[model samples]
Every structure is written in C-alpha cells, then in structure tokens.
Target: MKFIKTKLLLAIMTSAIISAPFAIADDTSFNSEIKKAIADSKVGISFRARYEGVDEDGINGASDIEATALTIKSRLTLQTGDYKHWSIGLEVDNVTAVIDNYNDLTNSYNGSDSIVIDPEGTDVNQAFLQFNTQKVKLTAGRQRILHNNQRFIGGVDWRQNEQTYDGYRIQYAVNDTVSLDYSFVHNANRIFEENSKKSNNLSGAFHFANAGYKINKAHTLSAFAYVLDFNKAHAMSSNTYGLLYQGNFGAIKVNLSAATQSDAGDNPLSYDASYYNAEIATELGKITLLGGLEVLGSDKGKAAFSTPFATLHKFQGFADKFLGTGSSTGMANGVEDTYITVKTTLNDVKLAATFHDLVSNEGHIDCGTEVDLIAAYSFKKDYDLLIKFASYSANELSNDTHKLWIQVATKF
Candidate 1:
C-alpha cells in the first residue's frame, strides 16, 4: 500500500514539474478555457448502485432458498491539460452483502475465494494518474483492466467493488491501424482476502506485461505475459501467456483466442492451466446472431482456473455458471462448454437471449444448460431501464435446482 501511494505521489509531482513552465504561457480561447477548468479544479464524478436477486436453487446437494445482493460504487477523476498532459483517477467501492448462501451461488468454501463479489471489504477501489498525447499515453495507480469480452481473462464482476491492479501502464500508437500497449502491476486486489490456514490476509504485489496489434482493418490481436509473485507465503507460483485474435467481415465477425500457463506448483497444487474460446457473430438487418464454444484444460481432471480474484461477472455467463474450476484437484482435468445468443433492437429498446450447455471436457456427464434473457429501453435522455432473468437446471444433481435475477441501472 505504501509503495502504491509513493507512485501516486510521484506521478503528481512529475505532472507538476512538466506543467510549471506553462504557468505563464500565452493562452488562446481553448487554452484559456482549459486553464479556467484547471483553476476551478479539473475533476469529475461517477456513481453506480445495483440490486440483484436469485430464486430458489440447490448446488451439490446443498439447498438454497431465495437471496439478494446490493452494491454501490463511486469514482472521482481529476485531470490536467498542458503541453505536459497529466491526470489522476480514484475509485471507492462498497457493498451491502455477499452472495447470499440461500441462493446456492456462493462458491467460496474451500481453497480460493468465491466467484461472486458482493463481499465484505473496504479500501479505495482504484487510484491512478495518466499522461497522454497523439503519440503516447501513460497511466499508473490502482485501476481496472478490461479486454475484448473479458472471457478467458477478467476481474470477477459479481462483486460491488471490482478487481483493480496497482500498477503503471503505457500505450504508443504507430498509426491508424497499429499500436503498442504495456502495463506493470505491483498489487492485485483480488476478489477475496488471502485465506491463510487461519488468518485472512489480503495484501500484496504482483507484476505483468501486455501488448496489442492490428493486422488489418478487420483483424486485431493481443498478447500478455504475467508473473504473480505474491507478498506472502505461497510457493509453486506460475507464469501466464496468451494470444487473442478478432476479425470482422461486413456484417459478420469472429473471435478466436488461446492461452497457456505454467506454475512451479502451489504446495500440492496441480500447476498449469490452458483455455480457449471462439465465437462468431452475424448481423441480419436489425437482429444479430452469436454462437461460441469454450474449453479449459489442466494436467489433472480440473478446469483451467481463471482469475478467481477477478470480477467474475465478465466470464462464463451473467448467470455465472462456470465460476471456478469444476475441480481444483481431480483426475479428469478439463471442462468444455458452448453457447449461443441473439440480439435485436426495437427503436430505443434492446433485447437479448442466450443458451448454454456444459460438461467435463474429458467426460460425457452433462454439467447443465442455462437460459438468460435481458431487455433495456433508453430514454432520449441519458437514462435507461433494464431487466435481466437467468435460469439453470442440472441433468444429474437434484440439488442443482435453478437460479434467477433481475436488475435496473441509470446514468447521466
């Protein structure tokens, strides 16, 4: 925490030094307006609060009644405009409850943290500083990192306070179609606190690097490599690397991604994880169609684990089907799944539906199938109303009954 604070202070000082000479520069209309805004204090504010509920369900013989969760988040943004180019961002997050156990969605019991996020925790959600120009952009602090669809990689979203990285990042644009992206993390506020055999410790530093490229107007790609050297006692850590490709052809688009990971072994942890996901989307006038498949593999019979510390809402499904590994340790080590979605717009209203089927990648036993429905209507203004519903039924486990949810959001 102290290291992150020092970096933040350093960024502020750097920006101040670069802008000192501009204190007396002759100002034009645009420049004067910018100066005035800064004088008044370059600042912005944003907030979000959401409520969700799930109907009765059972998971692995455990019974779940109905349950609900509420969360609120707010952010403050400060920026500067000068030949120096600089800005600062900070975020605050709070939640009313964790994933209610009655709904059976709470997957945090053994090993790592749970997949859902309405958890109990406090501290700033994020804080970062940025500098940018037509050619280069740089930022440092605790912040959110989002890529493509956030499938194979992502912060667990089911929580009110999302995941954030305490780090520095840079980007350089080579031209209209090509660019470079890089980042370094000194800390990761994972979804849950570090569960020592007895005490809960959630403090640490981790590092990583990432880059992106565009092959053409219709094709784009990205790559990443990271090493998570935690601040505490855990051995057999791992290194991760991956590639992603996306392409568009007129009304149709396809995305293919692959990743490989290696670990030294965590105590008795079965190290290494690999996963891939593919999807195709087609525009049919007012309606869009989507179909995709995903698979996770491990040396043992377990699903390749994603960032359990991430915002889980960004993965598997909004219903959060595949929250974590089907098994952290087992002989069958793999999980395969597929799904399809349909999206359409009616005037200012949007609608979408999805279906999913899952199973052990190396076994024939059915994991389950889920259906999700969503709809939204936007007022000519900045306000919008939304409704979401999810349902899942198991083919074998009777306790795997079902779950449901509904939500609404507004912004200006």
Candidate 2:
C-alpha cells in the first residue's frame, strides 16, 4: 500500500531525530527546561450532561420497552508547549450514568430494554506526542482521529464515551490549496470501555489516507481511501475509495460524493458494493431548504457496504435503526435514503426539521420513514443547551421507534 511507504518514511524521519547526537545536560538545566515547557502549556476542561429517552414498539426478538438515560461526561485536557518542535497532550475522560433505565448493549441488560448506548466508564481519551513544523506534522499514541465528515472513521462523540485509536499519523500541507493525511491504526478503542469483552473495539491494521484540494473559497474537493484488516472481527473488514466535493454558488450550495467498497484482507466474505450521495441547499430570508439522497448498494444480496467505525448516528436518521449493522438483511439488502431538511435561526436559537424516506437498495423495499427536530441555543460562550427528537414510523422493514434528547454542555 502507498501508506506503508509513507509510514516507513515517517519512521525514518523520526528515527533520524532520535538518533542525533545529544550532549548530557546537568540536572538543573534539565529541570529548568521541563518547568518552562510546563509553564507554557495549556489546559482545558469540558462537561456535558444529557437526558435521552427511547420508546420503541412492535420489534421482533427484543421486547419493546421505554428507556431513559441520564448521562454526565467530563473531560480534562492538557497540551504542553512545543519544545524543540515536539509537544505532548493528555486528555482524561469520564462518563457517569446518573440514571440508567435502558439496556446498554454491553451491560448486564444486554437486550432487555430499548437500547441506550451510553455506558458508564473512565478512560484515557487522548495521550499523544506530536512533532509539528510549518508544512508537515506527525503524531503518535492513543488519540482521537476524525477523517472528513466522520463518514468512514471518526470519534463517536455522540455517545458518552468517544472512540479513539492507537496509531501514528502524518499530515503534510503541500501548499495553500492542497493537503494530505495518512494514519496507521493498529487498534481501535470503541465506546464501550468498561465492558471490554463486549466492546466493539477491534485490533487491526487500518490505513487511512486523504488528499484535499481547494479550487477557491467556494469550492473544495477531497479523495480518500480506507483499508481495514481486522485480527478478530474479520467479517467487518473491507476497503473503500471515494471522492467528495463541496461548493457554493451564490445562495445555493451543492455536495456530491461517491465510493466503491469490496472485501479486504482477513474478511470472511467476498463482495463488492458502492455508495453515492448528493445534496443541494438554498437560502431565502432566514430559512434554508436542503435536499439529499444517499445510497448504499448491495452485492446481489450477498453483502452490503458498511462503515463500522463511522459516527453512524450522524447519517441515515437520528432514530439510529441503521447504526449498528450495514443493511436490512444483516449482510445483504443495502439501504437507500432520501431526505429533506429546513433550518433557520430565530432569537438566538437554531432550529431544524428533517424528513427521511428509506428503502432497500436491491428489491426497493420500503424500509421506513423518519422525522427529526432539533433546537439549540448557545446560552454563553462556554455553555450550550440542545433539544432533539426523532420519530421513525415503520413500513415493511423495522418497527416504529422514537427518541428524544435534552442536553447541556460547557467547555473552558
């Protein structure tokens, strides 16, 4: 792979610095240097509290139940100042379930009640050493990684516990209009930390690459490739290549993207699938109208395209029926979603409403429909409040489901 060569280059560059001659410094000098670096460091803290409720009925296998989850997540972060082009960051995270009335898939309740994925846990969210220059940057250790819009790889921040990776990353800026990024991920630490055995985290050789170019202020394009080879969860391993474009013309905006996927190393099955997405939006007065269509194709009912490490909650629908597995038939019968949205701001409150029509990719089965509503207000520079709701009505596919969330967050 191209990333392998890039990784070797990074290793060589890093080793050159490490193997350079260095004179031993006196204890006083060493301590002074450390103190200076600490004095120049920056520290930050964040707290988020959320109350989420889910009510679903008429589901097969799992019993229909109502669930309420009151979760509080706290984070403390410190970033040291650059010392000879090197810096370090440490972030600690803790999520506490103040009130838990649902089945967090990993908890003892497993599948007893409506699923609420936030489980209680404390973890080292990010601990990385970084070397940065004007054009190139390199980082290593456990850290949060988000590629593009978090479509293929991302930190699942919607859940109380965020996803992180143990890996090395390199980013280079070719010029003002072009940039490149690559990361070699060996292990992924998923959201379910307290229950490691049930955690969706995977050990793998994952390579992520992206190259982006800006034609101008109103237009930009990116190409990305993701290769995943799992050691244990072999069935989910795959490779994907895609391109993305975003541009604005006057009051109108547009986005187009497409990708193809196939089974990769260690995958238990062999299949090929594809994905396509396009969106357009326009603004009039205070309101904006947006429409989009997304398709995840199937390999002749053999397998469907899947992005297991993505922030799945951000796509399809907020009701989250399509979050875990790839398609309606587990490994086959892909998904096609058509959606429209209206958004505006009034008296400092941002509001949006979205409607989605879903179907199966191959047989064109009517999957379901969903309506989403959101209202948010940044009450202070460091504080915000949000209320969101999702209502999904069933068709021939899944059952009816509804979810509601009220959250308050603060950062400093």
Candidate 3:
C-alpha cells in the first residue's frame, strides 16, 4: 500500500512538471512565449572537491579509529525565464567518492573506520514551478527553503548532497514592513543519499509558517510555528513555536530568540521543552567578535528540544557531537552550548575561530568542549579554497575526536 502511494505521488509530480508551462500559457501567444522563455533561460554548473580526515580516541576498549575520505560533488541547474508570471527551475547533483577509506555511515559503514556522511549518488536536488508577482510568490514541487538564518528550517547545503523538501511554498509581502511565508512539506530529502541503507528520507506532514515585521530600519521581529508529523520517525514529531528579534545598534548587533516544543502526532513521548538563544556581535578594528548562549531545555531528562530539520552542523559545534538530541539514540538530558567566535579578513582570506563549552541541561553532565578553525579564500570571481579543522575533547560525552577538511570549489 505504501509503495502504491509513493508511486502515485511521483506520478503526480512528474505530470505537474510536464504540464506546468502549458497550464500557465495563453492560447494566443503560447508558442512565442515558449520561445522567449527558452531564450531567456539560464544554466548554472558548479563543482566542489574536498578531502576530509578524522581521528578519534578508542571507545569501549575498541581500537582508535582513523580514516580519510576524498569526494567531489557536481551540480547543474536550469531556470527558465518567466512566461505569464510562471517559471520553472531544475537542479541535479552528483557526489562521487575519489577515496572511500572512511565510512559514509550508509552502505559503506565498515565498523572500524570513522564516519563521514557524504554518500555517493546522483539525484534530482530540486525541481519546482514558480509563479511570482510584485508582492506574492508561489512555488510547488521539490524545492529549497530557508527561513531566518536556518536555525529551525534550512537546506543543509554544506553537505555533499543538500537537503531539500518536496513541498509547496508561498510568500506574501503585506506592504513594505510586514511579510508572511509558509510551506507545506510532504517529504524531506535528507543528506544521506538515495542509495543509503539508512532511512535517507522522511515522509511527513510538515507545516511551517512565519510572519515578519520591520519595527524600524535597524530592527526586525519575526514569529514562527512548525508542526511536524513524521510517518515513521514518530520520535521527531513535534510542534514548535518561537519568536526572533534582531537589532543593529550602531557598531553593535543583537539577536535573541525563544521557542517551545511539545510532543505531537503519534509520538509516544509526552513532554515539553524550551529553547533559547542570545547572541551579540560587534566589530573591533579588523576583527569581529561574537558571543552567545544556546540552551535546548529538557523535560526532566525524558525528552529534549531538537532541530532535526535544521542545519545542525552550523550550530552546537562543527564536530557535530550533539546532532542526535531528542531522538532515541540521542541525549535525552538536553544540552547547553556556550560559545564565542572571532572572525577577520586579511589579504583576501577569511578566517574564523570558535570555542564551545557543552553540558547537559538537566543532569548537569559535562558533555565536552571543542575548538574550530576555518580559513577560506575566494579568487577569480567563482573559485574558492577552504581549510577547516575541529578538535573536541570529551569529559562525559562521546570520544575525543579531531577532524580536518580541505576543499576547493568553482561555480559558473
């Protein structure tokens, strides 16, 4: 039965993709519009090659794991110009393993090597039909959606294969200062590629809504609500509501957010948790300093707040030690992340460093501390070179681990 439903959904999407242009075309100028649209369409291509190495201390008296992976991703995208306020977009991506010594955490898990999440596969990254006007925009089919810094929702573009959604999205600009955005997501195409043995995709009824108001030129406030009901991943089903505020005061900037989550759908857990983030940033001479505290509160060690759909690597720490929070395999005690970052640019090279102090929210267990460093240089308009490193020292959390990455990318 499930297989039949899946096939039916795919058929509908295929039909929509094939018939969108005709559905939006006018009978009189259909041929001319089609020709014009093709003439004005754009194509994009990009490639990224990276090498990652990981070293970890032995756990449970097992041998220490050391591994390296070299991988490359190629992407192609096309965007057709508007014809009667309608357009089409398509993106395809392929990830290839040049050196596969490390476990991909998918079909390549060898039990002895450190894990790298970049699996090898080719798939459609995004395919969407969009209709746009001055104040309103609508999109349907597989698409990428990012809301307000991607703390709650985002396309995990950092990975070899980005995370995208099969969904419908709409955006409305209510005058200049107020705006609204919403998406109804039916499936989540995760970073784990289609060939993975793991549950690489999630089928769900997910609704995301946000409203933004510009209080003034330097201040913006937004409110959001997300309801996620996964068909198979019941533990991740939850309802979250939050408010965010960003302010720029002369040389200083402030960001504050607060959210709450509760069990929903068929989730067996009955719990409520709170989430909070506060950060401030300011520039000093050639350097920028940022400090913040992010807390994912716990419900008496039974459940914790989690952002399963977020770009998890951008938060907690780059080592990704706390990505499994709120799930059966995750930390039920929740987490408290206190961190600071320094960024500077010199000689056309961008440099950043961050430090994190992690601990459990309920049990007060010291999780670990991590230091991350990154240096990136962009040249020749569309070329980039990057080097990054992370070291995590454990206390009560996972193992002591270190990771390094070197990457070069070009897009045109």
Candidate 4:
C-alpha cells in the first residue's frame, strides 16, 4: 500500500513539472483578456527534489545505522492584485517522500533506520495579507521571517516543509540609510511536521525588533532585540540584545557581531550568557579565502548562549553538531568554533569548502573537527543542481558522522 501511494505521488509530481511551461503560457495569455483579473496579480511555482543519505554510529545500542531519503517539495503561490493598498497571498506546499528508507520520526515504523528530519506531508505553507507603501510595509499571517543574517531568527528553508510563523510583521524605512523592523509572533510552526507527536509547535508572545544603518558601500551596522515568551515551552523563553557590523576594505570583508542572552518570562532558572563572532574574508583573483571564530559562552553551566530559532545548519558546522537546544538551555556547556573557508567560481559552477575546529569555552576541551564541501551549477535560467557533503571527526563530543546530498531545484 505504501509503495502504491508513493508511486502515485511521484507520477502526479512528474506531470506537474512537465505541464508547467504550458500552464504558464496559458496564464500569460489569459491575463491579457482580463486585465482586472491578473493585472497586478502574480503566481509562482517552485519545485525541489533532493536525495540525502546519513551514516551515524551508535543508535539505540546499535553499532551503526545508515539511511537514505528521496524527498520532493512542491509549492504553488497566488497573489491577488492590489486594491487600495491591500493585497492577499496564499501558498500551498507539499512534500512527498518517494524513497523512505529512513526514519522520518513521524511514521509508525521506528528504529529500523537513522533519523532523517524531512518528513513527507502536504500543508498550507503561507497565507498572508499585506499592506505596503513606499516607506512602510505591514504583513500579517503565516509567513517566513528572516532577520539580519538569519543568526538569531530565520525560516529554516533547508527542510522540506520549512519553518514558518503565524503572526504579524512590520517594517519602516526611516530614510535611505536607516530602517526599523519588528514582528509579533503568536505561534511558531516548526519543521518537524504536524504529524510528529514530538512538539512541532511553540506558542508565545514573541517580540523581535531591529534597527539598521547603512554607512556606505563598505560598511553597515545594526542593533536588534528579541523577547520570547513561550507558553507551552516556558523553559525556552529568553531575551536577547545584540549588535552587528559588516564592512569591506577594498578586497577584504569583515563581520563583527556580539550578543547577550538571559532567561525571561517565566523561565525556571535565572542565568545570563554572552556570544561573540568575528570573520574576515578576501578575494585573490577568482578564489576567496575566509577565517572566523565564534564563541557561545555559558553562565556557570546554568545557561548557554542560544539561538534556538536560528538557521543553525548554516552555522556551527554543516554537519549540524551544534544546532542548540530547542529551549533557552541551549548547550549545557559553552562552545567555541574556529573555522576557515574557501570559495571560487569556475565555468559557471560555484564551489565552497569549509573546515571547523570545535572546542569548549568553559573547560577548553577539544570537541571535534569537521569539513564541508558544496558545488552548485545553474544549467538553465530556472534550473539548478547542487551537490554537498559534510564529514565530522569526533574527539570526545558527539559522534563521527557523514552526510551527502544531491538536489535539483526549479522556479517559475
């Protein structure tokens, strides 16, 4: 029965892709006949198919566990024409697992395979009402919100379903170089998918604010604050304040960021911690070289600097050794990551490699090391192919693990 269902879904998705060009062409022609129907309105479609494999040691007393997953993400979006400064958008997304040789953590079958986060399902991804002007924009509904650099907050787009928020957001441009952004989040729809009995939602009165200033082409600065109050998960609630500076000097680019975090709004414990980050990069001809250091400190083992809602996969390491705790506790101990990266483009193909050395900030223990590699090519204007891999060598932290991914994505 599962096999039949999977095959049927694959066929449907294949048909959708094969008919996209014709559908788009018809939409364009139909707009001309009814200007009022489609003048300012727009439609978008995106599809991504990915194959991922994971090999990890020591799972449920097993020596090693390996698993593979083939997942497809299909999204369709529609927006009506603006009418008196009001426009509405609706997006539906579906994720189908054609080859489910892994544990999605959502299925009745369990323990036979390693855990793969991408679960198969279909759901309403986004539905929002937007009001915009030259200087101010207001949006309310289920949407994706990415703050500066996605360090503290972001839509975890790497996952199949993708994380989204149910709330309201506002942005105002004070001037050409200054702006203010804010959001009030009522609930956070996590990436675990709705079927997983594991807590897939977080509800709270979450407030986020940021003020940014662009000094010039070479420099920019921003300050931000986040006050999160979790009703269902109070232990994860916290308040944070931070500053970020990004600047460039000729061919050298630099990033300096720092933040302080403390328990807030019904948290069981009282603790404070700090975070620091620094990075510098330069391009030598076609190759770019970069190095950086990041520190997430702990307050006497009571609390650690945390970004529970961050796009953690983009940081720490691609192997995702330190995705942080879902709550304010974060890592029970402090962490420090020192890393270097190289990037270049060759024959329309982009390539990047990074190496990381992980350590403990409190006891200064050598945690682990990891290497990451990525290659991407855009074969057509609307199509792309990507290959990525990550390997982590453990010392005393976590376990030795390796992951590989191959993906093809299209947008229209």
* TM-score to native of every candidate shown: 0.78, 0.90, 0.94, 0.89
Encode model 3's per-residue lDDT on 129-182: one tens digit a residue. Answer: 899999999999888999998989988788898988888999999999999999
lDDT of 1 by residue, 1-412 (tens): 1123566567557756755654655767656755664675455555555567655455555555555555554445555543347655555554444344422123344422223335444556666677879989888777777645655335545455456667777888888766676667656665543332222323344544556787888899888665555555343245667888989988889998888766532424556677788999998888899999987765554434344344555444566655555335332345577889999988767999988787766555677787878888867575556677777676752224344444444443
- Per-residue accuracy of model 2 over 1-412 as CA lDDT, tens digit each: 0012343345446644643422334577655665666578899999999999999985677667789999999999988777677887778888889998877776456445687878777777777789999999999977889988898888888988888888999999999999999999998878775553364567889999999999999999999999999898787889999999999998899999999999988777899999989999999899999999999889877788899889989888999887744532373788899999999999999999999999988899898999999999997588999999999998997789999999999999
Return the top candidate by TM-score.
3
Candidates 1 and 2, the one with greater lDDT: 2
How many steric overlaps does candidate 1 have?
14
Q: What's the distance in Å from true for residue 102, model 4?
A: 1.5
Better of 1 and 4 by lDDT: 4
lDDT of 4 by residue, 222-314 (tens): 999999998977777899999999999988899999999999999897889899999999999999999999998888777777787788889
The backbone clash count of each candidate, in order, is 14, 0, 0, 1
User: Which one wins on lDDT?
Assistant: 3
TM-score ranking of the models: 3, 2, 4, 1
Error of 2 at 412 (Å): 2.4
Q: In what order do the candidates fall by lDDT, top score first?
A: 3, 2, 4, 1
| After superposition, candidate 3 runs with Cα above 4 Å error | 1-28
Q: Against the correct fold, how does model 1 do in TM-score?
A: 0.78
Error of 4 at 366 (Å): 2.0
